[model samples]
Target chain A: AQSVTQPDIHITVSEGASLELRCNYSYGATPYLFWYVQSPGQGLQLLLKYFSGDTLVQGIKGFEAEFKRSQSSFNLRKPSVHWSDAAEYFCALNSGGGADGLTFGKGTHLIIQP
Target chain B: DTAVSQTPKYLVTQMGNDKSIKCEQNLGHDTMYWYKQDSKKFLKIMFSYNNKELIINETVPNRFSPKSPDKAHLNLHINSLELGDSAVYFCASSHRLDTQYFGPGTRLTVL
Candidate 1:
């Protein structure tokens, strides 16, 4: 079975500090990776996705992620964190398309400090 | 504009009862999916429909059935709701291989 792991359950960073969220996936073939953000009382918004081609992909709201096949990881990063960035971040992967369904990580709760 | 939407954002029902949650997406996506978020915030896929055809059913109980009236709508009906069924249900839609847009989700509480 394909599985996603987000080692960090909770992470707190000061405003303007750098942020990184780790995601590791287990699959047999080249996987399609994605990152999503969810705000309080809201649906998840897609941040970025990596299907093929580029290993580093850019997403919305000053977010980016690097897909490292060598490490079987796709870690999300932001140069600087903002208070508004506090939310739950989830990493998902398409083990196989056409209804295989995305296997999602438990998610990481991002906290921003003043 | 609203991309995907689900009705009864909050639902509270008793055990052994039946309920249905409706979902509609205006994004013109051909694929629709239902996901569950548990109390611990763990997300899991329950079902998926493509072009009104059942494509994915992931270890879900037969008591839970999904109905797709058209390309834009998919409804979930639960029978004999149990306490374990209490969770946040999210509806999402996507094209053949594009990004999926999620709805605000319906919080179901079974007592």
Candidate 2:
């Protein structure tokens, strides 16, 4: 079974500072990757997805992630984060089939410091 | 318009009681899924239906049953609910195997 591992349980970044959240996946083949953000008491919102492309994918809210096949990682990055970016971010994966559904990480709690 | 919606945003019930949470999606997607988010914010897929047929059923207990009356609707019914079953249940839909759109989620609190 495919699984996602987010090494960071919580990360704090100052406003206007760059942030990076590490995510690694264990899948046999090339997998579909996604990043989702959820605010307090809210549903998961898609940040971005990576199917097959240039490895670097940009998502909503000025967030981006790079899929490094050799590293088995798809880490989300933001050059400058705002206070509104403080939320729970999840890394997910799917093996490209309805049956596979999606395997999600435990999530990283992003805390923006002023 | 909400792409995916789940009814009873907050549910408070006692143990051993039966409850149901309804989910509907207007995206006309062919696949729908149920996921549970625990207190620690760990999300896991429980069930999935494709065109009203069960496509994926995870290692969930038998007390939790999913009913898909149509392609656009998938409802979850829990019988004899336990305290461990208290969590946020999310409904998601997608066109085949693409990115999924999630509902607002139903928070179930079992007393």
Give the top-scoring candidate (TM-score). 2
lDDT (Cα) of model 1: 0.93
Q: How many backbone clashes does candidate 2 have?
A: 0
- Model 1 per-residue lDDT at A68: 94
Pull out the clashing pairs in model 2. Answer: none
Best by DockQ: 2
The lDDT per prediction is: 0.93, 0.95
Each model's DockQ score: 0.78, 0.81
lDDT of 2 by residue, B4-91 (tens): 9999999999999999999999999999999999999999999999878898888999999999999889999999999999999999
lDDT of 1 by residue, A1-114 (tens): 899999999999999999999999999899989999999888889999999998999999999999999999999999999899999999999865676567899999999999
lDDT of 1 at A11: 99
